[model samples]
Target: MEIIVVIGGPLEEGAIRRWLHQKLQQKDNQKFQFIGVDGGCLKLMSEELPIDLAIGDFDSISSGDKEILKNYAAKMIEFPSEKDFTDFEEALMWVAKSYPQQKIHVLGAFGGRVDHAISCLWTMFRPELQALIPYLSLEDEWNHISFLTPGEYVIHKLEHTKYLSFISTGSVKQLTLKQVKYPLNHQDYDFPIALISNEFIDEQMEISFESGGIIVGQTRDSWR
Candidate 1:
């Protein structure tokens, strides 16, 4: 099964509509199950989408909206307003437990507050969800980002997205980049600004690292 978790980020209504439509067009949509986190519930409801479960503290959503969610959602899991886990984290935990083998596509996770965006990206490090790396993606209007472990991997360049950036999550050693406009070999990249912007020239690109983790951001156009 494919799980699509829509988190409640401060996204524009138009973007939300477009994203939901694009999601419905995916080949996996037939197998896609929707889970809403906080304001995400409202977005799904606005699109008349079927929500399998609603997981959040509901602090961002109004009481009326919560009532509507309780009516339409197959299952509802509510947490205290002052909880340790963010709504997105809670939703991910549920997915990790219920659908370990499923691919999770996270939307409305970016383009909000910067802190939220960073938090959403770091969700991949949750102990329970760490084993499911490469299965979770955080997508926004301009880019798609995913984490990679220490191994060689092939990433196909998305149409119209010419630039790809790799940011080391930890100290990376012996990192190699191939089939790109700017290639690197056996280099060490520190946390930030080391591998900021790199362009992909071909249809496919490959990257490998001997040790440590990295976040690969495939972006369209330019980073503003």
Candidate 2:
């Protein structure tokens, strides 16, 4: 199963638009679902994509658009604007609960206010969703990000760029990187390290760590 969830964030690239359209059209052979959170519903409607479910307080959408959503969406769930979680957080929690075994692709999760972008990335660390980290990613036009647990992962390089960044909000123990331009072995870091401009020497790169987790961003500079 593939679940694509669109959040209310900036999505400006024309390529991203085309890619999403292609994805929306390829649901013929699998269990696919499209969910729009808050203004994401408006964006999907504007882009002429089918939205299976809409979730959020919806304060960001106009009443007219909300009416249209009510008619077009298979389900529309509204929460109070004063809730503890943000719209995307609520939507992600729902995904974590409902589709624990499904692969989740998140779009429109970045390119917004700096804090919002941070929130989008940090949401992957939520306790309930932490176990599903390997099956989720926050994607945009040029970036594919996934949170990694304490294990050895053979990650394939993205053709978009030779850049791969490893970010740890907390400490990482005995982190090792192989088959990359700059390799690290048994390293300890207390802060986030971008490990920027690192090229993959082989088709596959192996990353491992003893403790803690990190978010790996496979991205390109040209897209920003």
Candidate 3:
């Protein structure tokens, strides 16, 4: 089963519904465990989606909202508001310990505070969650973010994704991109840089790197 972690970030109901619809169709037999964090649980409830596990501090939600989450959620875990990690990070840590093998897709993790956005992106590299790097991803109305380890990958263009981008999370070497508008040949990047706005030449593209990791983003200008 794949796990979906919902946090309190910018959410477009229409975009979320469409994304969920496509995912359901693609994985007809797949089971999903939805983990709602704080106000994120409210979003799942508002959408009339099942909350398999609701985990958070509940400080961001009202009593009524907490009641709603409790009634609908299959399992719920609460933490102190004054804690070391953010609610989102707590949820990720729980998943890492409980369902380490399952791929975790995060929603509502972008927008809002710049620090929170950056924290969410860097949280994947935490010592506890580093093993889940390749299995982790984040998505919103306009962007889908994923991490890549050192390997050759055939990336199929996501529907309506107009641009492809790569950002080095650390020092990278022997990076190559093929079948894309701006192809690269064994390029070495010593520091973090963004290779942004690359377009697909066909239905798919190739990415290969010998060392370090990269953040891959498939994005669009608008929902339309």
- What candidate 2 gets wrong by more than 4 Å, as runs, is 13-16, 21-31
Q: Give one digit per residue, the lDDT tens place, for model 3 in 78-161.
A: 999899998988898889899977888899888788888888888777777787887888987678899888999998998857
- What is candidate 1's TM-score against the reference? 0.89
Residue-level lDDT tens digits of model 2 in 126-157: 88567678788888657889889888999997
RMSD in angstroms, all models? 2.4, 2.4, 1.8
Candidate 2 matches the true fold with a TM-score of: 0.91
| Model 2 poorest ten-residue lDDT run | 13-22
Q: What is the lDDT of residue 176 in candidate 3?
A: 98
Give per-residue lDDT, candidate 1, residue 181: 82
Superposition TM-score, candidate 3 onto the true structure? 0.91
Q: Which runs in model 1 stand beyond 4 Å of their true positions?
A: 14-17, 20-30, 222-224
Relative to the true structure, how large is the alpha-carbon lDDT of every model?
0.80, 0.82, 0.87
